[model samples]
Target: MALTKLVQLENFRKRSGSETSVAKVLSYSYASPLLSSPLLSSPQVFNCTQLDDLLEVYYLSPLYALEFCLGFPGNLLVVIGYVVCLQEWRSINIYLFNLAVSDLLFLCTLPRLSWLYANGQKETSPYACIIRRIISYFLHVNLYSSILFMVWVSVDRFLLIRHPTRNHFLLRPKVAMAVAGLSWLAINIQVAPLIVLMFQDMQKAINSSRCTDFASLSGDTNSFGYSMGLTLTGYVLPFLGLCLSSYNIARLLKVQDAALQRRTTSYKRPLRVVTAAAAMFLVLYSPYHVMRNVRIASRQEWSGMELCTRMYIEGLYILTRPIAFLHSVINPVFYFLMGDQFRELLFAKFRQLLRKTGRQRGAT
Candidate 1:
């Protein structure tokens, strides 16, 4: 009877173990749906949690505000300076004019970005989300368009100095306009898919106000690829183009005939303008592009960097981004300081404004 009881006890233990195993399987079955749900699977939800609030408030907000304050009027003056001298618009000036317009459009988005940063991510309305996406779209448009037009200007200057008689057809005002239009079209086409993806992602986040945080997007692989591609096309290639153009122009400036040099004294201002532009691209824009790539890499799953390292990269990106915005303000300064024609026109406009104010005062 004792042996029988031992057997029954062992059997009971096996039954209980089976029951426990079955219960675990049932629990896992029930939990799988929850794990697979969109809310749980969405990467943005986790990315948003990881975002450094301190970086946004103390650094990005103030910098964006400062950029807005300076860039708006600065870019506006550049546009006005070009516009006031419409009759004098050459192929090169057309490119510069478009660059100023791109900068102005970019500056328009800063106030909204500033407000978004200052307020933090509250529950964003759908309209607000749409507006933010549009702004972000144009921000990128401005960036690449500016780079492209600057390349055009550099190439034009290069040809003027290096091969003045080779590409006479390309130096026409109509040809410049056509090139500018084609550039705009190409950029818009490149960015259209990205805009669509952004909008779709924003729509999915029904209550999120963080429209500008691309780091919070789904699919790390896609984002990483896009960022890398943008870095290459938008920055690396253009920078190489500028460097080559500048080098050629510099060599030509050094080795020209004395009579040709005397005749080209008027070209000194444009040469200075081109040199300043190249320097600006190197100093202000290169760091931002490098940091942007680093930041994007840190956001990827395979980066394998520590949290502190990632945070450092994020901070560096924020700092460098504002430096890029400084280009808008500084470009106008380049125009006024380097381009005698731009300065003359700007001064004439100011004088006309002052005279009008005096006339109004006298009438009053």
Candidate 2:
């Protein structure tokens, strides 16, 4: 919001003609109208508001920097660990591996924003706008495809338990690749229009140009439709599918023996994994999307927020960025905790403990 205040102040300056120096500096980008009122000519657009400028210098930049520095490295490490530590050739693991790669593409753009803001929003360019859009496209695709793959994994488990004889085809390697491909294609179809609507030739409102959901900006009708679509496609359906599968799996386990139930629950760690992934999704993404949709519905600018609203939005930064990074990081932890092969590989210490316990019981 502070950064937005600075831009608005710049806009007011560009409205009155007194601030020739500021206009001259921003003119190099060829997007002087971004801050200036469109009706005012460049020479006429000079004026400044004191309170707005003071807040910009004091608040937004430092807070944004602190958030980014903590999230970036952890996001990168998630992808690296998955590739090196995970064995290849399984379909589910491959999709997760690629998901991490997509998130890292997003992680890479933060420093670009950090630099742009640290320089007082002067270094922003049209190319940065395009980069932001491209990164967003990939990130959205990852969001959809990752959830779709998880649903597929869940249903496959559901079938494997309920009808183990006939539909075992769901577990094949080739079929998983086909599922992955179909997931990517479907998400691409959903998000391709965002590329057309990206509005990347200019920068606006400070550093958020580094990442954005431009689909939410296409006037009220399109904005409402886009949010609904995102809410349904990215959120509602995924959560529903996960809950349904978990419900069925839990029900099916209820009639089994105690020993079998323990073993089954141990192997069902993927349920917990998916649940954590969804929680992180809600944590990081919900606030950003909700605020964006609210902005669209109200048809107001970002700067008009009251002090409390602004602080709440700013405060979400602590949860939002880290959870986004955690979305990338926790998948590897999921694999380490849940993957059957990795479990076998790492359970050697547990094996020793079990053996010692068995010997002690026999001696007694």
Candidate 3:
């Protein structure tokens, strides 16, 4: 039965084109129960160019554009509010402000990505690939930077709750600024290797005409190991830190509730903030990381229908990319929620401007 299918596929390939190779080895389980576990000596290689291009055009392009449009206003407002309205900066404010800046930078890269995805087939210029590589570098920079900043924000909030006196050295703005600078340096260090890998991928004839996301780049064996290492240090550690921070805050809240024999709304706010940050991390980051690892693994040796399944996983990975970035649009909410003084000051500034405008109109 396998021989019959093999002959048929060979004939089809010959008729299609000699240059195109679909699958070197095919595995099928449809014949009978015994054929389900049939062993294959070699791995199957299926070309996913068409699928990649299709998803790039239809799936990623529109999503990136929409994310940029929706995320820009909120992130810009947060940046402006932090710079103009907020008179004093706290540790959380510094962290959240950095996060807002990171989101804005990330969002700024999306339009170029969208255009690349939309017109990827036509983009053959060397400069375009260079721009894509640079954009990809900054995208990861902002992504992991935002993650680290949020982790700091959560930990800072927890410490503030643990010590209401606010005497924690790490809670100082200068200390926080230094931490933010180190966070940027750390994320850049983590993402620096990607640009080299992406350059090597561009040398491949398969990737000659296009640039792909790091997970989607083939022809490089080192990318898989690098990706695993990146996921570990860039995401896993920060996620764990966030979880620990949230857990400690919750425990403190519980102890306070029990000791006071009453549930005070004051403690609940920090508890809610940390818990929400943790929830956001889980909801947004987890799937992207899981699917990214899976996507990389899918490029490994596999045969038959498993290759087809990997194709579907690739599509799912593509979908997760934009969803993970939804954090940019959502971070502004945190900006408003985490910084009471910022929010209040922002509203007051707006009100003052409105009153001035009203008085000027009356004078006219």
Candidate 4:
């Protein structure tokens, strides 16, 4: 009986004339003794390769390119403006400077990311893979560091309002510098595990291209859990800090207005600015964090979910990536609006340059 079964399997393999067909035959032949069915047809594999190709080519490519173009010049001007126009560094200035620097670092990755997306293939070369890993590392580092610094900025504003005359330690430049350093260290430590996961992904895809977004990496079963933990620590905590700081500042401002018998509109500007910052924070980050988890969840096998539904979730996740980074462009505007002195100083410097050029032209 075993010999007959083996002969029948070999004969079927010979007649099918394709490697895939023969593999299917072998997969079923060893399972049962009787060949009751005519032949085991190849099972359909659920693949989203074409969907990924289209998303990379259309969505991420243009969006990342736009971010690089808009973010680079704005962040560069912030760094330059800080160095040139500001002679005295305060705690707020320290945080703002570091925030600009973090944005610049993240912006540096956008061009390479844009190229990778436009090409619509994962990187195969070791050098390219290493670069992609570095990009991922710095990307999260910038993200968390930026959030921490912004939280500090909100706290600084709160402190200035709450204790206008007192020199609180948190309001000191040296202490702010220490906080900034620790923030960078903490963010790096938090993001280090992602590098290991990416490395494992790289190893698994040695024969094929790899280096996808973290939500899409197929390295470890714990990736989804890790992502959830990261979102809570990196985003949720800082968001709460910002909200608390902003709320206290608004309350203090309102109290001061009542004490002085001033019009409600007298403090309206600061109140509005603080409220807007918090609102912007929620709008930009909440969707990204939510959709990212959904994307990761969609990759898992579910009882009754369709592949098309998973594709739609991934597409929404892709849309949030660039939108979350739009803060880089909005941040410079905040610099000018929030710091009246800095804006005046920057404008004065530009006018001085213009005057010098005009005088030189006249001399010639």
TM-score (all chains, Cα) for each model? 0.77, 0.63, 0.84, 0.83
Per-residue lDDT tens digits for candidate 4, residues 121-203, read: 46768888789889988888887887788888888777876776638999888998999999888888888889888877777
Whichever of 2 and 4 has more TM-score, that candidate is 4
Q: Across residues 93-209, which tens digit of lDDT does each residue of candidate 3 receive?
A: 989988998899989999988888899634577787788888888888887888799899888988888788889899888999999988988898999889778766677634355
List candidate 1 segments past 4 Å from native.
1-51, 162-167, 257-266, 306-308, 337-340, 359-364
As a TM-score, model 3 comes out at: 0.84
Candidate 4 versus truth, CA RMSD in Å, comes to 8.1
**What Cα-based lDDT does every candidate model obtain?**
0.68, 0.52, 0.77, 0.75
Worst 10 residues of 2 by lDDT: 43-52
Per-residue lDDT of model 2, residues 1-364, tens digit only: 3345447435433321122344443553235454455445332322223332333334444544554555456545545555455565554455555555655565565555445445544425656656656655766676566566667666665665566553566666687778777777877888776665555213333344333344223322355567668768876787688778777776665544444645546545555665665565567557656654554443234234432243344333323433443454444455455343644543554587799999999999
In the range 206-290, model 1's lDDT, one tens digit per residue, is 5555565554444313766787787788777887887777777777776774446465575555566677777888888888878
RMSD of candidates 1 onward, in order: 12.3, 10.5, 6.2, 8.1
Cα displacement (angstroms), candidate 1, residue 164, comes to 6.9
Name the candidate, 2 or 4, with the larger lDDT value: 4
| Residue 125, candidate 1: alpha-carbon lDDT | 79
Total backbone clashes of model 2? 11
Q: Which segments of candidate 2 are over 4 A away from where they belong? A: 1-88, 120-124, 159-167, 200-221, 257-265, 300-325, 343-364
